[model samples]
Target chain A: MFRLEVRSSTPTWFNFALPLLAIGATLILCSGLIALAGAGVLEAYGVMFTASLGDSYAITETMVRATPMIFTGLAVAVAFRAKFWNIGAEGQLLAGAVASCFVGAIPMPGPLAMVLMAVAGAAAGAAVALVPATLRVKFKVDDVVSSLLLNSVIYYALMALIEGPWKDSFSGYPISPPIEDSANFPVLLEGTRLHLGVVAALIAAPLIWFLIVRTTLGFRIRVTGENPEAARYGGIHVERVLISTALLSGALAGLAGVSEVGGVHFQVMSDISPGYGYSGIVVAMLARLNPLGVVPAAIFLAAVMTGAEAMSRATGVPAFLSDVIQGTALLAMLVALLFTAYRIRRVGVAR
Target chain B: MSAVFEQIFQVGFLAAIIRIATPLAFATLGEMFSERAGVLNLGIEGIMLLSAMTGFTAASLSGSLWLGVLAAVLTGMLMGALHALFTVVLGLSQHVCGIGVTLFSSGLAYFLYRLIFGQQSVPPNIKGFQTLPIPILSDIPVLGPAVFNQFALVYMAILAIPVAAFVLYRTPWGLSVRMVGENPRAADSAGVSVIATRFQAVILGGALMGLAGAFLSMAQFNAFTFGVVSGRGWVAIALVVFGRWDPWRSAGAALLFAFVDALQLRMQASGLGHIPYEAFLMLPFIFTIVAMAVMSRNAVAPSALLKPFRREER
Candidate 1:
């Protein structure tokens, strides 16, 4: 008889295989959804893969989309590693966008203006994050609820600003005035949408990895996360580490917001992000909170998202089908991770 | 100032506040029960959204608002049960699992709603819940109408506070539930089934959340829209934290949130309103976060809250 046995620690192979298994499972489940939608499953898959990465422009689009995911994913991964749940990435992103818009709207010189806008955006995002970080450290407020609620509040605040004070005077649209051309992120490729933001995010990934692996602060954060009591005994100042990580995470998430506005949209709008902050959570989880792994994980999500539109156009499948696939991937990954952590074993004969 | 007082004293404004607070109150209490049982039901927003769609569709089809409410409640329960299964049985992280449930349900609900209703140029409208005024209380000039004149669900929501408080702090089952939340190992050794208690609490909370969603679809508005819930679930979660796990306090926080919501709506409707509509829209969320920050310091959560329980080796 086939039997299952418990393992104290998951094997290395299982660790590497989990994400692949999750992707496979998600594809199988999504294929059923495609069939239900009256589309041929193979054709749907074909459209998705081809449209996401088949050509140069598609690849560029994927990178553009993946840029923000990389920053936000790293933001989340860093905080999660520190055992600090900063669910307010969305709010932070919005704050960053608002700040960037403010900086960009000012008539400053080109390079200095762009750098200042990025700095201002990062500052604003970090400032918004300070409330929850302080509350979690000082008052023990659950960061999850505060961060989530703050997101809506920030979104509404952005809407208020754009619709009220910052409304485009000439166009009468509910969007901010476009930033000066000099303040905008320079496009990296002549014919592609990819911008300097992609470079910023790519650089941030390895920098974060280096910080976690080499720095004293990173050591404190890891120690605090592993054992708060022991870390406290060791004089690590757990709360300080948490607060710093939360702020850093917020800053990174803010950079994502900056990239969206300065890099892509060139102006701040109310719906600046299509839940990139939330999507970052999935990317972080899929990467197992590894800073280095975030790059590949983000690219995968970006591909799936980019492909969904193509699949929809070609096969009459709803682009929203991608959301189902994404959600299923998250769920499958969680289950796979849990099984890897601990397996149930029969103590004796089967009942 | 007197004129402002007079306006605040008006029955219509009071009624509006109570009406607005009704769904929030029910959901807050439901969240209270779930959190108190050591499970944070972050899926509350998604549950409300799904229920709103289901309840609205059912009522529209059956031509009975009550039946629609039932359908909404049942759907909420199922979602709640799913959450409980994942968090309580499968031992998944409450935060992630809750998020998954919300995303899954929200997307699924939207998909299904569009599939069934088709994207009509105008949204479907249905008959809404009618008010049932308390005979004696309705006679009072302003207070009576504001407090007593409401839909049946509103009355049920108001009644839930004391009932919830009594059940949570008074009864044997309540003690077991609290035990499970406080110290699951001890509770398990003392013959309390931790899994069963948590499951029950979550289901009960889900049923209430369903009723809350039904109220949004069946009473407050005569139709269901994609944004019906509108971050109310997050508001409820914040209220639970602000209230510090007490049923009455949670209800009070919900009432406070309702007042802000009503005030914002009123300001938007008033021609002399100074605040931007979006600012008003964001006020409740801002207030909730502030309140959470203030109350978080001394807040005493359940000892076992958010930690999945496993029986210790004998």
Candidate 2:
């Protein structure tokens, strides 16, 4: 009943249509899950979409949530494009947050202090990544394991810091002291949580696109990712490029940490991030590791995260359902993307 | 000096380490099977977490720890089957599949925990499994009590080491599994059902993972918390690589992790502790990375570990 179709490569239209198809499938599946959770799919979706976009305040909150995801998604995308799996972005983000916390606690001029803190945050995130990168380059260690283990260390370290030396004595809370006003990112809109981090991320998206498309380094990266032996034959420094890209990727993730601390929370807490690093993987994958595509993907993820609370409060559905949806979407996207590249060929006549 | 020896010689401390190491050892051994079969199951953390929650809930409801353990194992098997369906049958990326599984399971576990337990501040507690000391060995000094005095699950975990080692090395089935991991085409050529073997291994590994989760809830804590599994699954993953896919060696690596864990808890409890507990808490992770860096030089991962094995014609 089905006709055989042959095409040399996937067209641009197919590329755009694939994500749409994945989303359509995701929404239908999620609706079923929502109904299973004892909520009307329409009502649940209404509350979610409305609460996330109905008001200016809601939009700002969505942006605030999305800011770090943008950086993290880009971070993951950069490494993924280079065929390097840096699963340690969560740890690196924490490293940046911890480092910025240290910097923010220091007394200095406001603008200058903020700049220095961002730099330190980036450096700390990159430094934590160095362990995995160095091991991958020197000992051929799998970055996946090293990076994943580093997350546990970072988590414990943050926990220890908040519970001990960095504890907020005045408030009797397990949170770090608030950053100095000078170290805070200026809010972009009055009376809203949106801040300069959004601008930074926006600027970064285009810059990343440019770097990957218009530079000599980009050529090396694409060549290496496509074929390592071929890239080496072409006289590219494969190891150096991989290491530098990894560092750059980690720095972006660290900057996301800075955004959380400087532009949103103004202080580090044990729960500073709600697993944004992990969620970033979905964003990166959904965007197909295209840097420019990461923006909208991140925003969509942020919208889901932001709306989860409302969904929980209104429908009595746990907000974690959003996580399930995000994860399902990622799985669906991966499957769909795979099908796009390869199709199963029947060896025998149809029965 | 004798007092120092006496203090260090307490059977309780050593027994506690063994107890703690049991689940980690089980999970690490399980991961070794999957990794050796050429799939990196990062969903281990999620699998353990979900199984822990399900086992705890089931045990609390049924008032039977054994039933609870069974439920956990079944849940783990379900997750493993799901993973196999996605990664093997559907041919999805293992890493993404793992992350998706983790997210889905974690969310499901958390939601179910809230739905069943309600919004109570204090968590519910249940009767935990008691220790079953070997009668004859209980009377012996040092090694006897240390090895003999443990929960039923602990003994099972200990037995699993040799069983796993035997299956992995001395058996033809083990050779087929290794061949699938190293070269699927060759395995397929030799009449080994690559997909079937991989699916079997993944599910088998998943069952052990579930048992490990059950041990945490039914034996170790007698309570369930959101963070019960913590990062133990990640530690298990590291142990797999560090152990070089050998069950005994992986178990040894697991014991080292337990030592660090036990030492941290002990240091936290000790009044004479010098370092911040955070520093101590970070020790295992830091050491894991450093050790991986050092040992990875000569380490040989399974040739097909993270790569999807597609038939050449595709």
Number of the top candidate by DockQ?
2
After TM-score superposition, the amount by which residue A175's alpha carbon in candidate 2 deviates from its true location, in angstroms, is 2.0
Query: CA lDDT, every prediction?
Result: 0.86, 0.85
Q: In model 1 chain B, which range of ten residues has the least summed lDDT?
A: B1-10
Candidate 2 structure quality by residue, lDDT tens digits, A227-270: 98998998998999888888888998999999899888888898
In candidate 1, list every pair of residues with a backbone clash.
none
Highest lDDT: give the candidate number.
Answer: 1
CAPRI class assigned to model 2 = medium
DockQ per candidate:
0.66, 0.72
> Which digits, one per residue and each the tens of the lDDT, describe model 2 over residues B153-210?
9999999999999998899989988999999889989999888889888998899999
Give one digit per residue, the lDDT tens place, for model 1 in B44-151.
Answer: 998998998899999999999889999999999999998999899878989988887887778667766765676689998898999998999988887888888889
Model 1 TM-score, all chains together = 0.94
lDDT assessment of candidate 1: 0.86
